[model samples]
Target: MGAVVLIATLDTKGPEVAYLRDRLASLGVDTFVIDSGILGEPVDITPDISHGELARRGGMTLDELQHAGTRGRAVEIMRTLVTDLVREKFALGEVVGGISVGGVGSVMGAAAIQVLPVGVPKIVVAPTASGHHEFAPYVGTKDVMVVHSIVDILGLNPISTTVFDNVAAAMLGMLRAGHPLGPPSADTRYVATTMLGNTTHAVEAMKARLAELGYETVVFHSNGVGGPAMEELAAAGQFVGVIDYTTNEITDPLTGGIHNGGPNRLRVVGELGLPQVVVPGCIDFSVFAAGQIPSALAGRPVYDHNPEYALVRTPEDEMRQIGRIFADRLNSATGPVRVVVPTRGLSIPSTPDGPFWNPAADAAFLEEVRANIRPDIPVETIDLHINDPELGRHVAELFSTILDSTRPKEALA
Candidate 1:
């Protein structure tokens, strides 16, 4: 592990930032602080890289930004610079971990998410972490950690001091427990899988079965972040095959759910020539924040998913659009593919006699997919629900067969 990157608007929180940096130093973790404040003068510690370097790297000048007389321009340039600098440092193995201390609506927190990759130790200390619901714009699919400061980051007070000490410790601990990504193993290729709470059994079965097939299973939750991370990494050639058993993110936008992973959800893996076995695991319903005022999904069937999120049934019309999206993306595949539809159910509550059960909608959804899918691509219907333990085994068998077929003649029996 290298120096922990500390970022702050040093012009305002210079003394407080110094305390944070020194606190981590006391714990034996070296600190590299980035200055992002444009309005005031930085004090005490010299910035390794200043706001001038950032603006220049962003294809602009600090003078030009000043001449433009807009703080927004400064914010934009600093974000671009920080993102570029952080990524460069990470590639050079200079950043082992990172922390950004910012006030409400600071672009610094959002930039932290942009710069850091999935597993790197990244933390953002901000007031928004205390219950801010508008999260995806800031976090996206990154694995950055966040801590609520409970107070604005100005001159250090008891609460601010306490928050700073706790955050420093957390960052130090994360760096001490270091993690570094290894080169992809050639002995066993990666198999990416997706799972929701509704499909946990299927994922467990798939993981064990794929292990026996000599393929490592990488499961991504179909949450807002996980789906995007899996797809992007797949395009980067991280996985040899994908058992995408949970495609619920596709319908999230159609039904106004917070878990909507961007629209480019299924576009990457196909373009990368990765073999895949897709499933309609839990596309039947959309999830909404429970207890809070729900999205304006009038007349749609809704059920309490948990205390935090509510589940709502997808209309046949929206399901049809999702079907077309599936076909359109899969049609571009340069490798083998499969789409599995569990005939009895799509989710736990979508099965017959369940709360969200509506056979008509399910039939409409499946029929559209079956009809629109490329003729060469096979779409199979299983007689079980998506969560049924056997469905996992069934999908695993199909995926293993795909892997076997792709093997060279000399590598096969």
Candidate 2:
């Protein structure tokens, strides 16, 4: 196996990158450097074909990106380019491991490496190592490791040099140990799907169809980590397509539901520009633990779906906010996006004569979408209930259509 491709904007990180390259060489490992600098002297390793090429492969190119200067451009360029490059390299068995270093740029660029097949020795040493990793969800259950370089990423000082050397050693050891590459040769196209208990039937149905169609289905519980994790894979170009079947987590987050998926929930797919089909699967209510329900909702109807999970019906006011957030996110997607709404009900309890049925709140959210999301984004509202087999199939077909449209024409050849 070859070296773990050490990726970084070599222009600004000349000293640090060179130090890492030398260390890896000394350790008897081959290293390939990718120059993502927009404007600078020629780099040692092949540069990304072009900045526009990076944007076309994912989003924003290095040259067209709005950054501060050469350093900033290199950072952005490397972040996006390295992710795509590493992804491709790992796919082709050209790399056994990957390492990256930077502050925000390093973290962003390295996130792609982290998403590589589990146990391929992924390590990222970042300058900004404090706080909740907004990118952790994408890393998922992968064995990706992070080392904090307490000092800022400037020239290679004693501190920064030590950090990089240690990180390089860790990655080298991991690769040498030779962890098992996951199950033999199953080209399972990963399909990222979202689910909550209320929307289990639809998600399962979608999963069944995807499996029948020869795809590996990864069902995210949508219990805070699920949605974000699924989105992370999408951003890393890990997902062949996505079925955003249940978006209630956004409402859960907005209404102080114990299961909030955070603000960057919809951002991953939008940034990665993937074919997406969204539904208000469980939008009618927010989930919470029985004890965490607010006093204001004391008299409001509360139902225990299970001992561990409880549901609180959303009020008209909160639904408006949910609508605003959803619309704002959907409007920003650059890919072929479609939002599907089930008019009959969004969840099990929201069905006709069901415990959580409330048309006013659902209507309010739908109205917001109609008014705010652009016409080009494609909004489809169905008359059937969310779990209805007909509605399920309709959604599945819609997602299939969008996915097919997004496929590269060359694949057909």
Candidate 3:
């Protein structure tokens, strides 16, 4: 195992971090400390890479970084250098699992750890870890583990010590557990699937078919975080093909919904040149958690998905916009691809006479997709709902054909 890199602002989190280093040292695990702080008086514990060094590495000096206007920039610079430094060290087998303690003003440390590779046993202990909305961004698509300190990390008390001890043990546990530290292995090829609650039947059906065809299926919920993670894995060459069944995540960004999967959702799969079967699953509604629906949409009809979640119908205009975005993305694909629409419905609730049904809006989206997509990119419409068994079967068959066509084979024997 490479050394456990202790990350923190030695100027502020120095005492607690030193205590942690000493504790892990007692346990016979090698440790290295990196100080990302910009300004502070020196502490008794010297860091392997002091804050001063980090500032210089970030193209700033100590005095310059102390200014109010430059502190945020300095932090960002440090994040860049630190990420590169840690990644380099990891390639050389100098760093492995890591731990950091944060309270307030600890954004830099958290940012640094976030850059570490997934499955590296990285952990961040912060008071905000429990309910902070920022948690999702901090660990986007990465498997970085966060532990809620439940108490401020300002001083080492009973709670802090117990928390630190647990973190140390956890990090060591993961390191010794022989976790992956670099590029993923390609022992088995997998298919990536993006699904939503409304598109569950389709995904389940496709998954079963894909398994029978000897390909692994990795399903992602097309919610806020799932879409990003699935896409990130796809970009990393984690899948042989993508089943783009849930186009709902893109609607969030277009309509200001909380589940905005960012602007790069469908674009990643297309750019990868991976074979895919795209469907307009759940694109008819924009989902939001309880109490988060925008004021402008207050008058619009919504489906009370549950006490904690809801969805608002997408108007015809918005459907057309989503279609253009979808087609623009698919047009960039270098691999085999096809767009299929379930004419009867996009979701269970959006069926012909269902509460969310609106053929005018659906037809608008479909027409836009056909108009904007490349002439060579086929667009097919079936007289079935998205969740219908017939539609699922068609999608599965199409994906199977694409997967086989995309598979690399020997030219001649």
lDDT of each: 0.79, 0.72, 0.80
Model 3's TM-score against the true structure: 0.93
Tens-place lDDT per residue, model 1, 28-83, is 88888887876666776677777777667767677775565577866766666677
lDDT of 2 by residue, 128-210 (tens): 66544555632444666878788877777889888878887887788778683554234567778888777777777777776
TM-score, prediction 2: 0.59
Error of 1 at 374 (Å): 2.8
Per-candidate TM equals: 0.90, 0.59, 0.93
- Write down the worst ten-residue block by lDDT for model 1: 104-113
- On TM-score, the stronger of 1 and 3 is 3
Error of 1 at 248 (Å): 0.7
Q: What is the C-alpha lDDT profile of model 3 across 1-413, one tens digit per residue?
A: 57988877777778888889988988888998987766785465788987677667667776766663766676677667677777778779888777766764455556666666667777888887877546664466667788888887777899989988988888777877757645545666688888887888878888887777767788888887787788777877777788888878889887788778887878888788888889989988888878888888877668888898899999899999999998998888888888899888788788656788899999999999989999999999998889876676678788888777766676212
Give the clash total for candidate 2.
0
Better of 2 and 3 by TM-score: 3
